[model samples]
Target: MSPLSLDLSPDLFPALTEAQADPDGPGAHRPALHFGDRSLTYGELAATASPLAARVAEAGRIAVWATPTLETAVAVVAALLAGVPAVPLNPKSGESELGHIVSDSAPTLALAAPGTQLPPALAALERLDIDTSAPTTSLPSPGAPDPESPALIVYTSGTTGPPKGAVIPRRAIATTLDALADAWQWTGDDVLVHGLPLFHVHGLILGILGPLRRGGSVRHLGRFETAGVARELSEGATMLFGVPTMYHRIAETLPDDPALAKALARARLLVSGSAALPVHDHERIAQATGRRVIERYGMTETLMNTSVRADGEPRAGTVGVPLPGVELRLTEEDGTTAVEAYDGETVGEIQVRGPNLFTEYLNRPEATAAAFTEDGWFRTGDMAVRDPDGYVRIVGRKATDLIKSGGYKIGAGEIENALLEHPGVREAAVTGEPDADLGERIVAWIVPADSQSPPTVDELADHVARRLAPHKRPRVVHHLDALPRNDMGKIMKRALTHD
Candidate 1:
């Protein structure tokens, strides 16, 4: 293999150009996306992207609150090829919130499927032409575009409250694709199974960009159904990138289908991200599918910085070591940054400096500045510790996800894990709520398993108190039918806190 090219000269458009040419060929006429009966090939995707790119060029800044379908996928790429910043908006956001985002972005155009309600302001713009037909020719090769130009504006998960858009430059895409092409072994020969939502960074960048840039085909899912995913695996797609929830759901449905096991066995890689991959789920997937999930850590601000590989033993409760071109550092509680990796028990703020980090939050200069340290490393608000083997375990987020009671820091993730072990619990989200005497207290919102009653707060607290330190046990619990999850299936802790 050729030495890894670190020049970073190739932008997304140029990368697409390369994908269109060479051994993979610019116009292979092979499949680009498949969701149920719809299958788009490279040539057709390029054809559709061209006119849409032309439309985007006319609009300048285009935002899409599109449903997670094949059309939404191609429209985003088309906007990028047109040299515009495409912001993927959640389809489930309310009109008030959608109006706010549309008004803030002030997009020149917005695309929506028929009958889908779009903000009046966005509705005034030209609607995207829905054409699932294949392209007549591959995207034309063009001169290298500016590598530093803004490619897309991705929003934060709003872990705190309202989501903010983070401006990711063209270089960010190139950097991620290059890294994954080596790190994750993406190549022309691979086909990725994509069950992630297009609006989220994991699904948009890593799920879409990384695979296409390397000339590999992507088989998409219109909606994530366990049976649909099982079907894709059975179809012989060699790779997959999905959130932990997707893996868990698939594990739930796969045990009854031997075909699912056979298909998963044929896959060369399976990755979990967007949220923590529980230690049990990690082991469960490996045991059930005969393939260990390559768990990694990343966020909307940065596309991807670290990964555990297909060749490595996936460490339970940890997101594997940093990927190439990623620099990891730990700042101690006293404000000293530790250059060396810390043991698994030592807690510190996780910092990363890498090519994949976003340029800035679109309009929030203060938020952008606050996101990084003095020397420019992005201060990942996550608290983590690196074990002796260099695997990084995410202890908790620095925000509300940490429960502080009796003067001890307790990770909601740990408590959530303990709750999930109970046979009665189907899902859970742990949060810290204001408590007069303790400053803050642990509270759990649980989804009870089918035909089983939810465990009482005292019962869960007692169960946790047996395994965890006294201060780590929950003080309150509420039983619900399901935890509120976002479009990507990540538990909405903010919503839980609001409730």
Candidate 2:
């Protein structure tokens, strides 16, 4: 898709051109964003953003209190228009975490909704109010800056240490969104709907900016709800994006709510990401609404690696092929690259080289240097297996999801998927514990559908043995009322324990 060049476009948001062409054209008057009772058309977005863009251009790097609001969207748009890098801060981050981000990024100013009460870390910075309804004089798009220059500084979840700032370039944003558009057949006419936070890539880059880049409209629910999804889809919205938790809620209520099921059935696309959507949830939604939820794979460092194409078979357990212009490989533990899986079960660490990758970790040269190979490929810590047809199925994180049991390399993801198929299991997470004989023993943590009569360890182990293999069976089982989950609905396996 244009030779995989970092020189993606002279103008990042090309759709803004429509605002200049016709002040009252269809594109100009078209709805650009909807959050609760508030909305901003394309015309309004440009006019409001242009003046703010000019204001922010001189502020250097700016911090955006990324609440899911129209003003937050405008703030980011203005930053991009002015060629200033924006760092989005998650409102949910604790004081210490926020302090780490604030100091690590060292933004010159913090921008937020007029009334947002930022924490001490952000409050310490010079404050700029982002007024979405402010009067404005629209200016033409700025001449392109270095495509490789930092456009955004996104913080990681910090499994190892304080969160590192990932420096995402403008080229990566353009390349990733365009590649996704090609895979999903995205167009200007597609009205997208979701209720995702504005801090992460899935929510901000893909959820909000993706729609804006395509010249389409987005209706944010302010927060995700089954009814909001239903209402939006039934009333002409063509696409829906959400995490597994949102879809799980949808699947749980679909049997009793025929209206919700009917509305979901009418939507053009239902996409899930941030984590794998359980096979049970996938099948339940499909059974009720004939809609197969497609999954894509990405991380903070890599914008998006692969996605199931709209025209391709929407497989239940795979993240499909790599997007156009992205080169992906599965590297064996020994360091050799494996292009295709010969046995269909061999797993390796996923590494990618593409324009859709971040340039560096903001201030940590050593960490940034270690993130890539000598030849330029970014070594993604996630492990996955590639099929003969090039479809990728992520098994788990390289550090946590890969389990060495009885001399067999097993992915915790497949075991978790199999455990979820059991009638008594409502949620499942698989992990490995040190075993004297087996090197590492398989362990299963389950949140039972019927907690009072939870499935026994023997019965669950036998179930996994029958479905998968004896080596893959869990040797130990832990039952919890609810598995610990992060904000994105990802199971926090590190927090689970048999103690």
Candidate 3:
């Protein structure tokens, strides 16, 4: 990798050019992005974005119609270059959710691909058409914006109430990307491939910007297909980033497809994030192709906190140590006291103090204040256990996955992992149901491998009892055609019905 200034800059896009140029580096002449058959060279990207950036420079904050297209990529780049905070609107969002975001953020203008149709919520806003083929003039200099100035206003999933917009400052993006570059050994030479959505942190921030920050190139699969992944990796893409769902599909297809396995084996890195990758899927992929899918942990509020280092052991089920400049700790479930020791058995709520953290929850100062501790550590509300080695194993979320039953505190993640090991179980989710005897009994929601011969509740109970503790075993089992999962493949436990 070429020597580049790591200093926090007013604009991030220009930093890609400052890195030492290799003849074959991801630069002006090299292909920067590929979506379907369409491609954009670094030079083309800069030219396209420069004009758009100049136009939107005065817009306070703009809403981006984030579809998996070159226009969406260019729109975000333009916003960053102009030093404007961009609020990425998910194309899949319903009217109510979409309305909430637009009303909350109150962006001056909405940007989308030329000739694209927008829904009523966004149609109300002034629209700016992004034309990548349009002629460009000289690019404007990135004037000094405060390092703490908002760069992106990302909304939460709104599982509790209306989604809150996370105010992501320029510093957070720079810190997170740099820390990841250090951990992943990312460089201008690497070519990343993924088909994740543009609206989320996993896709837009890490999948796209991470490469650009490191002077590397990226190829968007347009949509994630196992075949597409195989094709890209086989054709010279160096890294693959995806969620657990994508990996699960790859694992299921590997036995019948040696070419796919071989293609994956050749990649420099395969990363899974947004949710935990089941131990079963992790082992299956490793057994098929001698490579372990590395897992990382982060959220919309924090760009990225921890990742399994490229040089470190690709340990299954653990999201490795905290990233550089991130100070992480686990606090008691009560949220008062901090855990002083790492025993790998005790579970606590993960709290972090880092530059990667968002500045605030936009227009919601009360919510923002409630999210942090008095001394300023963000209470992540994620339950995790830390090994003696400092590796973190996220058990689940504090509100849903941490079950207090009878006299013990249990994490549903371990039980869910154990259930996935059963040959008859294709997928599993565990939740604590109201119980008469114990305070709450464990309930296992299963999507069977074979519907005709689904594993019985007693059999699943016995399996979990044998693998984990008896107390952790499910008291009841429910079968489903498929688990309700988000775009990132995280099972939406709250969506499950129990009666």
TM-score of 2: 0.97
Residue-level lDDT of model 3, residues 207-308, one tens digit each, is 888887776789998899999999999999999999999999999999999999999999999999999999999999999889889999999998899999
- Tens digits of per-residue lDDT, candidate 2, 369-477, equal 9988888889998888888788899999988999987778899999999999999999999999999999999999999999889999999999999998888999999
Candidate order (TM-score): 2, 3, 1
Off by over 4 Å in 3: 1-6, 14-26, 134-137
Local accuracy of candidate 1 as per-residue lDDT tens digits, 1-499: 2245654664564434544553246454566777667767666677667666765676778877667677787788777777788878887777767776776677877775556666665676666655656455554533345777778887775656566888888887887777767767777778888767788778878777776777667888777776666677777788878887788877776678777777777888888887887666766677887788787888778888778755566666778878778888877654455746565666677889988889988778999998888888888878777788788877778775656677776667777777777777778788988899998988888887863656787888888788766787888888787788776677877766544
Q: Give Cα-based local distance difference scores for all models.
A: 0.74, 0.89, 0.87
Superposing all C-alpha atoms, what RMSD in Å does each candidate have to the true structure? 3.2, 1.6, 2.6
If scored against the real structure, what TM-score would every candidate get? 0.89, 0.97, 0.96
Candidate 1: Cα lDDT at 363: 78
Q: Give the clash count for each candidate.
A: 5, 0, 0
List residue ranges in candidate 1 displaced over 4 A: 1-4, 13-27, 112-117, 130-143, 159-161, 333-341, 433-441, 448-471, 497-499
